[model samples]
Target: MSDLHELRIERHIAAPVDVVWRAWVDHQAEWFCPRPWRASVEVSELRPGGRSVVVMHGPAGEEMRHEGVYLEVVTGERIVSTDAFTAGWRPAGPFLVRIDEFAADGAGTRYAAVARHWTAEARDQHAAMGFEAGWGAAADQLEEVVRRLVAGG
Candidate 1:
Protein backbone atom coordinates (compact mmCIF):
# COMPACT_ATOMS: atom_id res chain seq x y z
CA MET A 1 0.00 0.00 0.00
CA SER A 2 1.53 3.31 -1.07
CA ASP A 3 -0.75 5.42 1.18
CA LEU A 4 -2.39 7.63 -1.45
CA HIS A 5 -4.50 6.92 -4.55
CA GLU A 6 -7.32 8.60 -6.41
CA LEU A 7 -9.23 8.41 -9.70
CA ARG A 8 -11.19 11.40 -10.95
CA ILE A 9 -14.01 11.78 -13.47
CA GLU A 10 -16.09 14.88 -14.00
CA ARG A 11 -18.83 16.08 -16.31
CA HIS A 12 -21.60 18.59 -16.75
CA ILE A 13 -25.07 17.14 -16.96
CA ALA A 14 -27.94 19.22 -18.25
CA ALA A 15 -30.29 18.28 -15.47
CA PRO A 16 -31.40 19.32 -12.04
CA VAL A 17 -30.36 17.72 -8.76
CA ASP A 18 -33.30 15.31 -8.61
CA VAL A 19 -32.70 14.02 -12.12
CA VAL A 20 -29.01 13.53 -11.57
CA TRP A 21 -29.63 11.79 -8.29
CA ARG A 22 -32.04 9.36 -9.91
CA ALA A 23 -29.58 8.53 -12.67
CA TRP A 24 -27.02 7.64 -10.02
CA VAL A 25 -29.22 5.83 -7.54
CA ASP A 26 -31.52 3.97 -9.88
CA HIS A 27 -30.55 0.27 -9.92
CA GLN A 28 -32.73 -1.02 -12.72
CA ALA A 29 -30.93 1.29 -15.11
CA GLU A 30 -27.95 0.19 -17.15
CA TRP A 31 -25.03 1.79 -15.27
CA PHE A 32 -21.98 -0.41 -15.68
CA CYS A 33 -19.53 -1.36 -18.42
CA PRO A 34 -18.47 -4.20 -20.79
CA ARG A 35 -21.75 -3.81 -22.67
CA PRO A 36 -23.17 -6.68 -20.63
CA TRP A 37 -21.74 -6.34 -17.14
CA ARG A 38 -24.97 -4.78 -15.93
CA ALA A 39 -25.04 -3.03 -12.60
CA SER A 40 -27.57 -2.43 -9.86
CA VAL A 41 -27.23 -0.19 -6.80
CA GLU A 42 -29.20 -1.46 -3.85
CA VAL A 43 -29.16 1.53 -1.58
CA SER A 44 -31.39 0.91 1.36
CA GLU A 45 -31.19 4.49 2.53
CA LEU A 46 -29.71 7.64 1.10
CA ARG A 47 -28.02 9.21 4.10
CA PRO A 48 -25.01 8.99 6.32
CA GLY A 49 -24.78 5.66 8.16
CA GLY A 50 -27.03 4.00 5.57
CA ARG A 51 -26.22 0.78 3.77
CA SER A 52 -25.67 0.42 0.01
CA VAL A 53 -25.23 -2.70 -2.03
CA VAL A 54 -24.07 -2.80 -5.63
CA VAL A 55 -24.55 -5.81 -7.82
CA MET A 56 -22.85 -6.48 -11.14
CA HIS A 57 -23.68 -9.15 -13.63
CA GLY A 58 -20.81 -10.40 -15.74
CA PRO A 59 -20.92 -11.63 -19.32
CA ALA A 60 -21.60 -15.11 -18.06
CA GLY A 61 -24.46 -13.73 -15.99
CA GLU A 62 -22.46 -14.38 -12.87
CA GLU A 63 -23.38 -11.91 -10.18
CA MET A 64 -20.87 -9.96 -8.12
CA ARG A 65 -21.84 -7.77 -5.22
CA HIS A 66 -20.24 -4.81 -3.51
CA GLU A 67 -21.64 -3.68 -0.16
CA GLY A 68 -20.76 -0.60 1.83
CA VAL A 69 -21.88 1.95 4.37
CA TYR A 70 -22.32 5.61 3.72
CA LEU A 71 -19.80 7.75 5.55
CA GLU A 72 -21.31 10.98 4.37
CA VAL A 73 -24.27 11.97 2.30
CA VAL A 74 -25.21 15.46 1.25
CA THR A 75 -28.42 15.23 -0.73
CA GLY A 76 -27.98 16.49 -4.28
CA GLU A 77 -24.34 17.07 -3.48
CA ARG A 78 -22.03 14.22 -2.46
CA ILE A 79 -21.62 10.71 -1.13
CA VAL A 80 -18.69 8.95 0.52
CA SER A 81 -18.80 5.24 1.13
CA THR A 82 -16.51 2.41 2.15
CA ASP A 83 -16.85 -0.80 0.14
CA ALA A 84 -17.20 -3.90 2.26
CA PHE A 85 -17.86 -6.28 -0.61
CA THR A 86 -15.46 -9.00 0.37
CA ALA A 87 -17.42 -9.56 3.54
CA GLY A 88 -21.00 -9.13 2.41
CA TRP A 89 -21.45 -7.77 -1.13
CA ARG A 90 -19.47 -10.64 -2.65
CA PRO A 91 -16.06 -12.31 -2.77
CA ALA A 92 -14.09 -9.23 -3.68
CA GLY A 93 -11.61 -6.75 -2.26
CA PRO A 94 -12.23 -3.45 -0.56
CA PHE A 95 -12.66 -0.04 -2.17
CA LEU A 96 -13.37 3.48 -0.98
CA VAL A 97 -15.61 5.50 -3.27
CA ARG A 98 -16.63 9.15 -3.13
CA ILE A 99 -19.10 10.36 -5.69
CA ASP A 100 -22.20 12.48 -6.39
CA GLU A 101 -20.38 15.67 -5.36
CA PHE A 102 -22.09 18.41 -7.22
CA ALA A 103 -22.42 22.12 -7.80
CA ALA A 104 -24.96 24.27 -9.56
CA ASP A 105 -23.52 25.66 -12.78
CA GLY A 106 -25.75 27.48 -15.17
CA ALA A 107 -28.82 25.33 -15.85
CA GLY A 108 -27.13 22.04 -15.05
CA THR A 109 -25.12 20.26 -12.39
CA ARG A 110 -21.36 19.87 -12.15
CA TYR A 111 -20.67 16.33 -11.08
CA ALA A 112 -17.44 14.76 -9.90
CA ALA A 113 -16.27 11.34 -8.74
CA VAL A 114 -13.19 10.39 -6.78
CA ALA A 115 -12.17 6.79 -6.18
CA ARG A 116 -9.42 6.13 -3.65
CA HIS A 117 -7.20 3.21 -2.93
CA TRP A 118 -4.95 2.26 -0.03
CA THR A 119 -1.71 2.10 -2.02
CA ALA A 120 -0.12 3.06 -5.28
CA GLU A 121 -0.06 -0.62 -6.13
CA ALA A 122 -3.76 -0.85 -5.51
CA ARG A 123 -4.28 2.20 -7.64
CA ASP A 124 -2.19 0.63 -10.35
CA GLN A 125 -4.32 -2.45 -10.06
CA HIS A 126 -7.39 -0.34 -10.69
CA ALA A 127 -5.76 1.30 -13.68
CA ALA A 128 -4.92 -2.09 -15.04
CA MET A 129 -8.43 -3.14 -14.21
CA GLY A 130 -9.67 -0.71 -16.87
CA PHE A 131 -10.28 2.20 -14.58
CA GLU A 132 -10.05 4.92 -17.19
CA ALA A 133 -12.11 3.22 -19.87
CA GLY A 134 -14.59 1.74 -17.47
CA TRP A 135 -15.17 4.94 -15.53
CA GLY A 136 -15.13 7.00 -18.67
CA ALA A 137 -17.83 4.87 -20.23
CA ALA A 138 -19.91 4.98 -17.08
CA ALA A 139 -19.61 8.74 -16.89
CA ASP A 140 -20.71 9.06 -20.48
CA GLN A 141 -23.60 6.75 -19.87
CA LEU A 142 -24.63 8.70 -16.80
CA GLU A 143 -24.64 11.96 -18.69
CA GLU A 144 -26.71 10.47 -21.46
CA VAL A 145 -29.15 8.97 -18.99
CA VAL A 146 -29.64 12.24 -17.17
CA ARG A 147 -29.98 14.19 -20.36
CA ARG A 148 -32.55 11.85 -21.81
CA LEU A 149 -34.52 11.61 -18.61
CA VAL A 150 -34.59 15.33 -18.05
CA ALA A 151 -35.47 15.92 -21.67
CA GLY A 152 -38.38 13.55 -21.19
CA GLY A 153 -36.99 11.10 -23.70
Candidate 2:
Protein backbone atom coordinates (compact mmCIF):
# COMPACT_ATOMS: atom_id res chain seq x y z
CA MET A 1 0.00 0.00 0.00
CA SER A 2 1.31 3.45 -0.84
CA ASP A 3 0.59 6.79 0.77
CA LEU A 4 -2.95 7.87 0.11
CA HIS A 5 -4.69 11.22 -0.09
CA GLU A 6 -8.29 11.95 0.71
CA LEU A 7 -11.02 14.48 0.04
CA ARG A 8 -14.21 14.41 2.01
CA ILE A 9 -17.49 16.29 2.02
CA GLU A 10 -20.47 15.95 4.32
CA ARG A 11 -23.99 17.24 4.08
CA HIS A 12 -27.26 17.03 5.97
CA ILE A 13 -30.19 15.92 3.88
CA ALA A 14 -33.72 16.50 5.02
CA ALA A 15 -34.69 12.92 4.43
CA PRO A 16 -34.36 9.59 6.19
CA VAL A 17 -31.40 7.32 5.63
CA ASP A 18 -33.45 4.90 3.60
CA VAL A 19 -34.80 7.70 1.50
CA VAL A 20 -31.39 9.15 0.93
CA TRP A 21 -29.98 5.77 0.04
CA ARG A 22 -32.81 5.15 -2.34
CA ALA A 23 -32.13 8.41 -4.07
CA TRP A 24 -28.46 7.59 -4.27
CA VAL A 25 -29.06 4.19 -5.79
CA ASP A 26 -32.17 4.76 -7.80
CA HIS A 27 -32.00 8.36 -8.89
CA GLN A 28 -28.30 8.72 -9.44
CA ALA A 29 -28.79 10.00 -12.97
CA GLU A 30 -30.58 13.02 -11.61
CA TRP A 31 -27.86 14.19 -9.24
CA PHE A 32 -24.59 12.45 -10.03
CA CYS A 33 -23.22 15.59 -11.66
CA PRO A 34 -23.58 19.30 -11.22
CA ARG A 35 -25.74 21.53 -13.36
CA PRO A 36 -25.00 21.63 -17.10
CA TRP A 37 -23.57 18.14 -16.83
CA ARG A 38 -25.69 15.00 -16.95
CA ALA A 39 -24.95 11.51 -15.78
CA SER A 40 -26.39 8.24 -16.96
CA VAL A 41 -25.81 4.87 -15.45
CA GLU A 42 -24.91 2.25 -17.97
CA VAL A 43 -24.56 -0.43 -15.33
CA SER A 44 -25.14 -0.40 -11.59
CA GLU A 45 -25.12 -3.39 -9.29
CA LEU A 46 -25.61 -2.60 -5.65
CA ARG A 47 -23.53 -5.42 -4.23
CA PRO A 48 -19.97 -6.29 -3.44
CA GLY A 49 -17.93 -7.42 -6.43
CA GLY A 50 -20.49 -5.98 -8.78
CA ARG A 51 -19.79 -3.62 -11.66
CA SER A 52 -20.76 0.01 -11.80
CA VAL A 53 -20.51 2.28 -14.81
CA VAL A 54 -21.53 5.90 -15.07
CA VAL A 55 -21.20 8.24 -18.03
CA MET A 56 -21.12 11.97 -17.46
CA HIS A 57 -22.06 14.08 -20.42
CA GLY A 58 -20.72 17.60 -20.41
CA PRO A 59 -22.49 20.67 -21.68
CA ALA A 60 -20.50 20.60 -24.88
CA GLY A 61 -21.30 16.93 -25.55
CA GLU A 62 -18.12 15.53 -24.09
CA GLU A 63 -18.53 12.27 -22.21
CA MET A 64 -16.54 10.84 -19.35
CA ARG A 65 -17.19 7.24 -18.54
CA HIS A 66 -16.31 5.92 -15.11
CA GLU A 67 -15.97 2.20 -14.76
CA GLY A 68 -15.47 0.68 -11.35
CA VAL A 69 -16.39 -2.15 -9.05
CA TYR A 70 -18.20 -2.17 -5.79
CA LEU A 71 -15.88 -3.28 -3.00
CA GLU A 72 -18.46 -3.20 -0.26
CA VAL A 73 -22.13 -2.54 0.11
CA VAL A 74 -24.20 -2.20 3.27
CA THR A 75 -27.75 -1.53 2.38
CA GLY A 76 -28.93 1.85 3.64
CA GLU A 77 -25.65 2.41 5.41
CA ARG A 78 -22.55 2.45 3.25
CA ILE A 79 -21.13 1.78 -0.20
CA VAL A 80 -17.50 1.53 -1.24
CA SER A 81 -16.35 1.52 -4.83
CA THR A 82 -12.97 1.70 -6.45
CA ASP A 83 -11.41 2.08 -9.86
CA ALA A 84 -8.31 0.20 -8.76
CA PHE A 85 -10.03 -2.98 -9.85
CA THR A 86 -12.88 -3.70 -12.15
CA ALA A 87 -15.45 -6.45 -11.96
CA GLY A 88 -14.05 -9.80 -10.79
CA TRP A 89 -11.20 -7.97 -9.10
CA ARG A 90 -9.09 -7.55 -12.18
CA PRO A 91 -6.27 -5.08 -11.73
CA ALA A 92 -6.46 -1.78 -13.56
CA GLY A 93 -4.75 1.57 -13.48
CA PRO A 94 -5.30 2.72 -9.92
CA PHE A 95 -7.22 5.90 -9.47
CA LEU A 96 -9.43 6.43 -6.45
CA VAL A 97 -11.73 4.69 -4.04
CA ARG A 98 -14.95 6.32 -2.97
CA ILE A 99 -16.97 5.69 0.12
CA ASP A 100 -20.53 6.85 0.38
CA GLU A 101 -22.05 6.75 3.84
CA PHE A 102 -25.46 7.58 5.20
CA ALA A 103 -26.51 7.72 8.81
CA ALA A 104 -29.57 8.72 10.72
CA ASP A 105 -29.47 12.31 11.96
CA GLY A 106 -32.45 13.24 14.05
CA ALA A 107 -35.29 13.24 11.51
CA GLY A 108 -32.91 13.42 8.57
CA THR A 109 -29.87 11.75 7.13
CA ARG A 110 -26.22 12.65 7.45
CA TYR A 111 -24.49 11.95 4.17
CA ALA A 112 -20.81 11.91 3.45
CA ALA A 113 -18.51 11.05 0.57
CA VAL A 114 -14.82 10.32 0.88
CA ALA A 115 -12.54 10.02 -2.09
CA ARG A 116 -9.16 8.45 -1.51
CA HIS A 117 -6.45 8.89 -4.09
CA TRP A 118 -3.29 6.95 -4.75
CA THR A 119 -1.05 10.01 -4.35
CA ALA A 120 -0.98 13.49 -2.92
CA GLU A 121 -0.50 14.88 -6.40
CA ALA A 122 -3.69 13.26 -7.58
CA ARG A 123 -5.47 14.70 -4.58
CA ASP A 124 -4.13 18.16 -5.32
CA GLN A 125 -5.14 17.81 -8.92
CA HIS A 126 -8.66 16.93 -7.88
CA ALA A 127 -8.77 19.92 -5.56
CA ALA A 128 -7.61 22.16 -8.36
CA MET A 129 -10.37 20.72 -10.52
CA GLY A 130 -12.89 22.18 -8.07
CA PHE A 131 -13.64 18.98 -6.24
CA GLU A 132 -15.18 20.79 -3.27
CA ALA A 133 -17.51 22.98 -5.27
CA GLY A 134 -18.35 20.27 -7.77
CA TRP A 135 -19.01 17.61 -5.16
CA GLY A 136 -20.90 20.08 -2.97
CA ALA A 137 -23.13 21.02 -5.85
CA ALA A 138 -23.78 17.37 -6.58
CA ALA A 139 -24.65 16.84 -2.92
CA ASP A 140 -27.15 19.64 -3.07
CA GLN A 141 -28.68 18.14 -6.19
CA LEU A 142 -28.88 14.79 -4.46
CA GLU A 143 -30.71 16.34 -1.53
CA GLU A 144 -33.22 17.90 -3.88
CA VAL A 145 -33.87 14.57 -5.55
CA VAL A 146 -34.26 12.85 -2.20
CA ARG A 147 -36.66 15.49 -1.01
CA ARG A 148 -38.77 15.07 -4.09
CA LEU A 149 -38.84 11.31 -3.70
CA VAL A 150 -39.74 11.57 -0.04
CA ALA A 151 -42.53 14.01 -0.89
CA GLY A 152 -43.94 11.52 -3.44
CA GLY A 153 -43.18 13.83 -6.32
Candidate 3:
Protein backbone atom coordinates (compact mmCIF):
# COMPACT_ATOMS: atom_id res chain seq x y z
CA MET A 1 0.00 0.00 0.00
CA SER A 2 2.99 2.28 0.39
CA ASP A 3 4.42 4.17 -2.53
CA LEU A 4 7.97 3.57 -1.37
CA HIS A 5 10.01 0.47 -0.86
CA GLU A 6 13.24 0.31 1.16
CA LEU A 7 16.31 -1.87 1.03
CA ARG A 8 18.81 -1.96 3.88
CA ILE A 9 22.15 -3.30 5.01
CA GLU A 10 23.58 -3.11 8.53
CA ARG A 11 26.75 -3.86 10.41
CA HIS A 12 27.79 -3.90 14.06
CA ILE A 13 31.13 -2.23 14.57
CA ALA A 14 33.31 -2.58 17.63
CA ALA A 15 33.58 1.13 18.22
CA PRO A 16 31.68 4.06 19.68
CA VAL A 17 29.32 6.17 17.66
CA ASP A 18 31.80 8.97 17.10
CA VAL A 19 34.52 6.68 15.90
CA VAL A 20 32.18 4.73 13.74
CA TRP A 21 30.65 7.89 12.39
CA ARG A 22 34.01 9.30 11.38
CA ALA A 23 34.97 6.12 9.65
CA TRP A 24 31.68 5.79 7.87
CA VAL A 25 31.34 9.39 6.77
CA ASP A 26 34.99 10.06 6.25
CA HIS A 27 37.73 7.59 5.45
CA GLN A 28 35.73 4.71 4.05
CA ALA A 29 34.31 6.80 1.28
CA GLU A 30 37.73 6.97 -0.30
CA TRP A 31 37.78 3.22 -0.73
CA PHE A 32 34.10 2.38 -0.81
CA CYS A 33 31.98 1.27 -3.77
CA PRO A 34 31.85 -2.31 -5.08
CA ARG A 35 34.34 -2.10 -7.86
CA PRO A 36 37.49 -0.32 -8.89
CA TRP A 37 35.66 1.17 -11.84
CA ARG A 38 33.42 3.17 -9.56
CA ALA A 39 34.57 6.44 -8.06
CA SER A 40 35.31 6.93 -4.40
CA VAL A 41 33.06 9.09 -2.25
CA GLU A 42 34.51 12.59 -2.23
CA VAL A 43 32.91 15.19 -0.01
CA SER A 44 30.48 14.98 2.91
CA GLU A 45 28.72 17.51 5.09
CA LEU A 46 27.57 15.96 8.32
CA ARG A 47 25.04 18.56 9.36
CA PRO A 48 21.39 19.09 8.66
CA GLY A 49 20.81 21.00 5.45
CA GLY A 50 24.41 20.48 4.41
CA ARG A 51 25.47 19.03 1.11
CA SER A 52 27.64 16.05 0.23
CA VAL A 53 29.32 14.88 -2.91
CA VAL A 54 30.84 11.66 -4.08
CA VAL A 55 33.27 11.84 -6.94
CA MET A 56 34.16 8.88 -9.05
CA HIS A 57 37.61 9.54 -10.41
CA GLY A 58 38.27 7.64 -13.56
CA PRO A 59 41.53 5.95 -14.42
CA ALA A 60 41.73 8.27 -17.38
CA GLY A 61 41.36 11.28 -15.04
CA GLU A 62 37.70 11.89 -15.74
CA GLU A 63 35.43 12.86 -12.85
CA MET A 64 31.82 12.23 -11.92
CA ARG A 65 30.16 13.64 -8.87
CA HIS A 66 27.18 12.27 -7.01
CA GLU A 67 25.71 15.20 -5.14
CA GLY A 68 22.95 15.42 -2.56
CA VAL A 69 21.36 17.50 0.13
CA TYR A 70 20.89 16.35 3.66
CA LEU A 71 17.23 16.09 4.54
CA GLU A 72 17.88 15.35 8.20
CA VAL A 73 20.83 15.01 10.49
CA VAL A 74 21.07 13.96 14.13
CA THR A 75 24.50 13.83 15.65
CA GLY A 76 25.51 10.31 16.59
CA GLU A 77 22.13 9.05 15.49
CA ARG A 78 20.81 9.52 11.96
CA ILE A 79 21.28 11.08 8.54
CA VAL A 80 18.75 11.29 5.73
CA SER A 81 19.63 12.64 2.33
CA THR A 82 18.82 12.59 -1.34
CA ASP A 83 21.47 11.87 -3.95
CA ALA A 84 21.47 12.82 -7.59
CA PHE A 85 23.46 11.25 -10.38
CA THR A 86 25.39 14.41 -11.11
CA ALA A 87 27.22 17.11 -9.21
CA GLY A 88 25.67 19.80 -7.01
CA TRP A 89 22.31 18.05 -6.83
CA ARG A 90 21.56 19.08 -10.37
CA PRO A 91 20.55 15.46 -10.99
CA ALA A 92 21.97 14.13 -14.21
CA GLY A 93 19.48 11.34 -13.75
CA PRO A 94 17.10 10.05 -11.07
CA PHE A 95 17.72 10.59 -7.39
CA LEU A 96 17.57 8.33 -4.35
CA VAL A 97 16.79 9.21 -0.77
CA ARG A 98 18.90 7.49 1.83
CA ILE A 99 18.51 7.08 5.57
CA ASP A 100 21.45 6.15 7.73
CA GLU A 101 20.90 5.29 11.39
CA PHE A 102 23.33 4.58 14.16
CA ALA A 103 23.00 3.29 17.70
CA ALA A 104 25.23 2.26 20.54
CA ASP A 105 24.89 -1.31 21.72
CA GLY A 106 26.80 -3.92 23.65
CA ALA A 107 28.12 -5.22 20.40
CA GLY A 108 29.57 -1.72 19.92
CA THR A 109 27.71 0.35 17.37
CA ARG A 110 24.86 -0.67 15.15
CA TYR A 111 24.95 1.09 11.78
CA ALA A 112 22.22 0.77 9.19
CA ALA A 113 21.58 2.38 5.85
CA VAL A 114 18.37 2.31 3.89
CA ALA A 115 17.65 3.42 0.37
CA ARG A 116 14.07 4.27 -0.55
CA HIS A 117 12.81 3.95 -4.06
CA TRP A 118 9.74 5.51 -5.63
CA THR A 119 8.68 2.29 -7.33
CA ALA A 120 9.35 -1.40 -7.54
CA GLU A 121 10.99 -0.89 -10.89
CA ALA A 122 13.43 1.59 -9.45
CA ARG A 123 14.24 -0.77 -6.65
CA ASP A 124 14.76 -3.61 -9.07
CA GLN A 125 16.96 -1.42 -11.20
CA HIS A 126 19.09 -0.54 -8.23
CA ALA A 127 19.38 -4.18 -7.28
CA ALA A 128 20.52 -4.97 -10.78
CA MET A 129 22.99 -2.12 -10.55
CA GLY A 130 24.70 -3.72 -7.55
CA PHE A 131 23.00 -2.00 -4.65
CA GLU A 132 23.46 -4.86 -2.20
CA ALA A 133 26.87 -5.94 -3.37
CA GLY A 134 28.26 -2.41 -3.48
CA TRP A 135 26.82 -1.38 -0.14
CA GLY A 136 27.80 -4.70 1.34
CA ALA A 137 31.36 -4.28 0.18
CA ALA A 138 31.47 -0.81 1.67
CA ALA A 139 30.12 -2.13 4.97
CA ASP A 140 32.75 -4.80 5.03
CA GLN A 141 35.41 -2.13 4.66
CA LEU A 142 33.85 -0.10 7.45
CA GLU A 143 33.74 -3.10 9.73
CA GLU A 144 37.45 -3.65 9.31
CA VAL A 145 38.21 -0.03 10.13
CA VAL A 146 35.90 0.06 13.15
CA ARG A 147 37.36 -3.10 14.58
CA ARG A 148 40.89 -1.90 14.05
CA LEU A 149 40.34 1.50 15.63
CA VAL A 150 38.36 0.09 18.55
CA ALA A 151 41.09 -2.41 19.24
CA GLY A 152 43.63 0.45 19.43
CA GLY A 153 45.07 0.00 15.99
Give the Cα lDDT of each candidate. Answer: 0.72, 0.92, 0.75
lDDT of 3 by residue, 1-153 (tens): 246777789988778899888777667554456446455655666776677777776667777777877778888899888874333445545547898889998858888988898778888888888888888887787777777777777
If ranked by TM-score, best first, what sequence of candidates would result? Answer: 2, 1, 3
Q: Pick the candidate with the highest lDDT.
A: 2
Clashes of each: 1, 0, 1
Candidate 1, lDDT over the whole model = 0.72
Off by more than 4 A, model 1: 1-3, 84-93
Worst 10 contiguous positions by lDDT, candidate 2: 1-10
Better of 1 and 2 by lDDT: 2
Report clash pairs, candidate 3: 39-56
TM-score of each predicted structure versus truth = 0.82, 0.95, 0.80
Best by TM-score: 2
Native-to-model Cα distance after best TM-score fit, residue 146 in candidate 1, in Å: 0.7
lDDT of 1 by residue, 1-153 (tens): 335588777888888877887777763346555455887766556667677777878888799876777777877788777774422435345765655587787898888877888677777888899888888788788887887787776
What is the alpha-carbon RMSD of candidate 1 to the true structure? Answer: 3.4
Clashes of 3: 1
